[model samples]
Target: EGVAAFVASQGTLSYQLEHFVDSHDLLGRSVCSMGSSGSKYISSHEDSDSAQTHEGVTVVDAGTWVSEPALWVEWTHTGRLESVGETRIFVIDAERMFKALLHPGLRAVATQYAGEFHKRVVTAKPPLASYPSDIEVPHADFCGIVCCMAHPWRVQIGMHAFRKLAAAGGFGTGIAAHMKSRLKHEILTGRSVLVVSG
Candidate 1:
């Protein structure tokens, strides 16, 4: 399942997942280009016993990759989005989420995720941060509070999403939504804080 925000419905063959960083410096600029080619079905691991198409991808400056001796391994490096801040930051698996969302037959899961996300968007408090961190509170921590909040600017993305970011107009600036609607529960077992309006 690929976790991407279809900010615009324009007819473009671009799969840019929403940026998952808090960097106003990168606003309105081309970050980088990304490419995903896991179908080549080449052996990733050195040992054939556990070898599989490890979702390897190589860089293509001319929008094309030349088959060379260079071995492409799964690596995630973010220089542009990495920065220190006073606010607590939580790191989430942006790459895995996108892989799941972009999967061919996960349309139902993608739709559910989108609807659930949008529902949380307009709420007084929505659980945003997940993973290991001190400030990373869960929905169960503050369920049914008068309000909830997350730094709308901060998000985490993988190399796949980063590659597509520059072309998709420097991440998603605006998220669309309908009139106020009831938020649905997509996750049930997670323990996170939920804020409610007072």
Candidate 2:
């Protein structure tokens, strides 16, 4: 649900814009040239005799042409701006912020509603076919049901079934005990098990 929400918020257009800007700035940094050219020639003049006077001169190509100085400068500046933008995005961490904003409300709603619904269902439903007695009954049914309830469509279906069972007052203590045992086993083993009785 969180992932879905995040993706929905950052639709394809936003993703494309982010990608384009990132790629463009990366290319600019790599392609733009920015450095001073070194002197190409060294010159020395000297006089001889007892004491000699010497002078050295370094010659540079002052008129050397840069293919696109203005363009390079622009690209460099753009790259810097892009980098700052990216850093700001991370520094702000909007994804984390969004999650923080949504988590409390969503979690509270799911916990209160879903837990009560599940409990009422268990209290009112007939026990699922007895374990081992109903050879056709799947051992993973409870776990599967839990997983299904997590899905949006199945959540509604599950809630409906819970309400019906609760209204009927069909669930028994034995079934609840069986479910508790199965849940305990799952917690211990780090694996899910179905409690058909519950």
Candidate 3:
């Protein structure tokens, strides 16, 4: 969260806007370009000159895109097989898969319902509607992972499973956990990597 502080004065903002705006007549993103074209800059901080910026936006990647997260698995198979054939299944780590899916955020919520509630807060991943007073606020991203992975095995969370996982204070069903654990340790079939470059 960021705080907003407005300091208003007669003709101050308007006067600044005159220099700040272009033909669009709006204080726009062009100002960052202006700096590249020798525009003036002011800084309140003593060492602001050394700070680096790019294209007017800073270099920060959001953990989760401000959108719902989903994982989709698809494969193309060929009939040709070796004489001594084998079936290989590749499973990605739940934590790593979730980490990559949630590359931008660790505890990012999916926003089914966010904001303060009358009795408690309602921030959870992938749209859960409630929380206990003692447990940590859940993440919507994890819920998305569980839901997507749960689809393949048809492991619906029943009442007993729900109660058991809930009793342990985890946001997962037993089937979901079993599915995720299988995914986490399932062997991979990616081509060997020789060069690692960003």
**Winning candidate number (lDDT):** 2
> Residue 14 in model 2: shift from native, Å?
19
Candidate 1 lDDT at 82 equals 17
lDDT per residue for candidate 2 within 1-198, as digits (tens), equals: 011111111101111011111112312211111113222111232111111222432222222111111211111111111121111111222234334656664554344434433332223212542211000112223344455444442344344444455456645554675775554455345354222232
Candidate 3 clash pair list = 62-104, 63-104, 63-105, 90-187, 124-140, 125-139, 125-140, 126-140
The TM-score leader among the candidates is: 1
lDDT of 1 by residue, 1-198 (tens): 211211111111222122222211112211122123211112221111211223431112221111110111111111122112222222223334445566554544334433333333223132443211111112312222211222121111122233354355643445323211111111111222222211
lDDT of 1: 0.23
lDDT of 3 by residue, 1-198 (tens): 111111111111110111211112211110011111112112221111222234332211211111111111111110111111222222233234434545332223212112111112223322344231111122333333333322222132223244454576655554577664443333121111111111
TM-score for candidate 3, please give it: 0.14
Considering TM-score, which of the candidate structures 1 and 3 is the better prediction for this target?
Answer: 1
Which runs in model 2 stand beyond 4 Å of their true positions?
1-179, 193-198
Model 2: lowest-lDDT 10 consecutive positions: 8-17
lDDT against the true structure, each candidate:
0.23, 0.27, 0.22
**Model 2 per-residue lDDT at 77:** 17
Off by over 4 Å in 1: 1-104, 125-198
Of the two candidates 1 and 3, the one with more favorable lDDT, higher being better, is 1
Better of 1 and 2 by TM-score: 1
